[model samples]
Target: MLDFTFTEEQEMIRESVREFAQKKIAPIALEMEKTRQIPEDIIKGMADLGLIAPTVSPEYGGQGFDAVTAGIIAEELARADVTGSIPVFYLVQASWGHIFDKYGTEEAKREVLPNVTKGKWFLGIATTESDAGSDVAGTRTTIRKEGDHYVVNGEKMYISGVREAYTRGGGHITIAKQNPELGTRGMTLFYLPLQSKGIIPTYVDDLGREGISTGGFTIDNVVIPKHYIIGEENRGFYIVHEGYEYARGLISVICAGAGLQSLERGKKYLKERKAFGQPLAKFEALQFRLAEHYTKLSFLRLGAYWALWTYDQEAKGKATRFEVSKAIAMAKMFASEWSNAAIDEVMQWQGAFGYTRECPDQAAWRAIRSFAWAEGSKEIMRVIVSRELLGKEYISYK
Candidate 1:
C-alpha cells in the first residue's frame, strides 16, 4: 500500500517555507535576474533559517530535518524564483556538505560542516572540469601525495558559486586523480578551501542565475593538508555518485516547482484575459491544455516526493543503490522534459505578455530550460533509464 499524506508538522513546514519564499524571495527575483546577483541579505536570512542544510544533523548546526522536509523547501523556494531562490546553495550544502559529514574524517567534518551549516563557509562540488563534465571518471585534476600535504594541479570549469563559496562560504569538494595508473579509481575527493594560495578563480558571466558566479579556474601547484581528503584515498567515485543522485532528485523538485509556478502565472493571466466577450478560461482549447499540464505537474509532484521518500529509506541503509538511482532518475528525467513543455504551454497561453522581460514567466522559462542540461542532460537521464530497464550487459551505449 502507498500513502502520501503530509503529517501536521510537514504541512506546517510547507506553509512556512511558502510564506518565507513569497515574502523574501519573490520580490527580488526579477531584480536578481536583471542584475545577475542574489542579495547577500537574502542568503543570510536563508542561512539563519537553516534552509541551507535542513537535512544535515543538528550536531553540525543544521535543522536536521528529513528528506521530505528538504524537498518541501526546494519546491517552495523554486516557486518564488527558480533561478534565485538559493536552492542551489542548499543543494550544495546538502549533497556536498552532507556527504562529507557521512564520509569525511572526523577532523575534516569538525572543521568544515559546522561552518557550512552556519553559512560561514559555502560548500560546493568541483567535479566538473573543462574536459570532464558528465564523464566524471575522466577528471584531469591531479593530487600528488607529498610530505604532510597533497600538491594539486588542474582546472575545473562551470563550477557554481565560485567566489561566493570562497568569500561568503567555505569551499568545494574537489575530485582529483591521486593515482594516474588507476583510471577512475585513481580519483580522490578533497575538501579544498579556496583560500589555498595557488587556487585562482577567473569569473565568466552567465545568462541566468546572475547573482551566482559560474566560472573556471586552474589549481597551480596548490598544496592541501592531507586531512582534507574525503573517504579512502583513490575511492571517492561512489561518494560522487551518491552526491549526484541527491542532486538529481533535488533538481527534479526544482523543475516541477518551476512548472507549477508557471501554471499559476497562466491561471492569473487567464482570469485577467478575455476574448469574444468571455474570459480566456472559456476557450476550450487553452483550458484543455491547461488541464493536461496541471495533471502532468501533479504526477511530477508525487514522483518528486516518492523519490525523496525512497532516498530517506536509502539513507537509513534500508534501500539498494539500484532502487535509489532508478527512482531519482525517473523523477529527474520526466520533470526536466515535462517542465520545458509546461512552461512553453503557459507562454503560449499568455501570448505576447509571456515573452516580455518584465514578466516572471520569462525567468521561469529560462530557469527551467537549464534543467534539461544541468545536473544531467536529458540524454544522460534517458541513458540511466535504459540501463535500469535493460540489464546492464544488454544496455546500448552512445
Candidate 2:
C-alpha cells in the first residue's frame, strides 16, 4: 500500500549527485575530516555544477528546485559523507538564501545571493549564543541604531563556518536585539559580513565533523549598514523561526541518508566477514537486530518525506503552521535518533575496526553523532511535538 516512486528527472538527479559525491568527495573526505578544512576546489566544483543554491530562484543564479529535490540532494551528499555534503552550506542556502530572496531588499539580494551561488561567498546563520541555543529570544547580543548604520556587539559561540566564511568572503545572517523593551519580539536579523570592521572569528576544535570548523564570533562594536536588515525591525524572531524550520527539515534528510548508508555498509560487512567458519550475518541474533533497525530507518525516511510534503503544502497555503511544525519536529527527532542507532549497529558489525580513527566507519559515526544535537536537539524536538500535540493544558508542571 506504500509507494516509493521518483520521477525520471528525480531519479537521474539522484544518481548524478550520488556519483559526483562518491567520485569527487569520498577520496578526500577522510582527509577533510582529519584536517577540518573544506578544499576550495570542492566548493568551486559544486558551484560550477550549480549545486550550491538548489532552492534559490534562477534570477539569483540558482536552480530554483523544489523542496523534494533539495531533500534528495542532501540525502545523496550525506550518504557519502556528512561533512562533504556540508551542513553549513545547505543550511545557509536553504535558510538564508531563500529568506533573502523572499524578504530582503532588492539591493541586498543583488549584493549577496549571486556571490553565494557562485561559491565566492559562504553564507551562514548566527543565532545561537553561548547562553542561548534553543532559547534564541533570550540572547544577550544587541544591535543599536547609529544613523544609517547599526552597531552590533556580542559573542556567538558554537557557530559553524565562521572562519571559512570570513576567509572566503561571505557572512552570516545574524540575529540580535533591536529593541530592549520588546524582548523576544523586538529583535532583528542582519546580513552581517565577516569583513566588517570589528568582526572577529575564533575557531574551535571539535571531536567529529573534522572537515567543518565550529567556532564563535566576537563583534566589537561591529557596524552594519541599515539596508542589511531583513524584514521589519523587532520582528526578527519570526524570520529566525522560519529559517530554523527550513534548516531542521533538510537536516532530517541528511540524518536519514546517513542511516541508509550505514545500513548498506553493515549488510556488506555481514555478508563478507565470517567468524567460526560462518558468516556473522548467519546468526539469528544479529539478523534480527539489523531487521528491526532497518524497519525503523525505513519509517524515518517516510516520515521525512511526509514532513517535506507538508512543508511544501503549507508554503503554498494548502496547510497550516501547526501541521507543518508537528511534521517537521517529528521527522527531525526520528531521523536523528534512529540514524545514530543505525550507525552504532553498523559499527558493531565491524568490531574494533569501526572504532579505529582511520576507518571511514569511525569518521561517519562521529559525524552522524553530531546530528543528534545539531539545529535543534532531540530534546527540543520532543518539546515542540509535546507543545503542539498536547497544547498548554497537557504541559506538565508536575
Candidate 3:
C-alpha cells in the first residue's frame, strides 16, 4: 500500500510554518537584501516556532522532526521569502544540526545544538575551498592530532553563514585531511568555531541572498578539543555526505516552492494585465508555457519528496546508500535549472517591472542561481547518477 498524503502532524507543521512565513517573514524578506542580514526579530520568530533546527532531538531544544517534515517547513519558507535568504538560513542549520545531533559527541551536542536550535547561533557546513568545490578529496585543509587536541590549518571559501556564525557564536561542520597519502579515507570532520584564535574571517560581495554572508575564512592552526570531532577520526568522508544529501533534498524543495510562488504571481498578472485590449492569459503561447512549467515543477516537487523518503528508508535499513544517492541526485540535478527557467519566464511575463529590483522574481532568479553549484554542482549530480547506473570502474573522477 502507498500513501502520498502527509501525516496529521506534518499538515499542522505546514500550516503553522506557512502562516508564520506569510505573516512575519514575507513582509521583511526584501528588507534583508538591503540590510545584508536577517533581522533579529525574524530569527527569534523562527526560534519560537521551532523552525531553526527541528531535526535535532527534543532534549537538544529541537522539534526532532524527520527530513520530510523539514522539507515542509523549507517549502513554506521559500514560498514566503522571495529572496531565498530565509530558506538558506533554515536549511543549512537543519541539515548540519541533524548531523551534529546524530554523530557529535555528547559534550559537543550540549555545547552547540542548544544555541543553534534557539537561533542564538548558526551551524554550517564548510567543505568547499578556492581549489575544491565538489571535489572533497582535493581539499587542502589539514587536521592533525597533537596530544589532547587537534590542529587545523587551511582556508575555506564560498561558504554560507561564515559571518553569522563568527559573530553570532557557532561554527561549521568542517572536513580536513588527516593524512594526505590516504586521500578521502584520511579525512576527519569536526566543529570549527569561527571565532576561535588563529581564525581570520573575510567576506565577498555576492549576487543575491545578501541577508546571509557568502565568503571564506583562513584557519591558521586553530586548535580544537577531541570532543568537537564529529564521528570517528578519518571517518568524516562518509558522514559529511549524509549532511550534503540532507541539504540537497531540502534545496530541491526550496526551488519548487520559489518557482511555484513566482508562477502564482505570474498567474495573477496574466489574468489582470491587458495586452492588445485582451488579458495576457488569452494568449495561447503564454498559456502553454504556464501549464508546462506547472507540470514540470509538480514533478520536481514529487521527485524531491521521493528522495527525502528514500533517505528515511535508508535510515530504517530498507534502502542502500547508492539508492539514496541516485534518487537525490536525480531530484536535485534538474531543480535549479527547471526552477530558474520557470522564474525566468515569470520575469519575462512581467515586462519591464520584472527586470527591476521591485520584482520579486528577479531576486529569486539570483538566489536560485547559487544552488546550481551549492551542496554539490548539478554536473556532479549527473555524475553521481551515472556512477550509480554504471559500475565503480566507470567513475569519471577515478
Identify the leading candidate in terms of lDDT.
3
lDDT, candidate 3, 258-293, per-residue tens: 999999999999999999999999999999999999
Error of 1 at 147 (Å): 2.0
Evaluated at residue 279, the lDDT of candidate 2 is: 97
TM-score, per-candidate, Cα-based: 0.96, 0.95, 0.99
For model 1, which pairs clash? 36-210, 36-211, 37-211, 38-211, 121-169, 121-170, 122-169, 122-170
Greater TM-score among 2 and 3 belongs to 3
The alpha-carbon deviation from the true structure for residue 241 of candidate 3, after best TM-score superposition, in angstroms, is: 0.7
List the RMSD of every prediction in angstroms. Answer: 1.6, 1.9, 0.6
Q: How many clashes does each candidate structure show, in the order listed?
A: 8, 0, 0
Mark the regions of model 2 whose C-alpha exceeds 4 Å error after superposition: 1-4, 82-88, 392-398
Stretches of candidate 1 above 4 Å error?
none
lDDT of all predictions, in order shown?
0.81, 0.81, 0.95
Q: For model 2, give the 10-residue run with minimal summed lDDT.
A: 82-91
Clashes of 2: 0
Best by TM-score: 3
Give me the overall lDDT of model 3: 0.95
To one decimal, what is the Cα RMSD in angstroms of model 2 from the true structure?
1.9
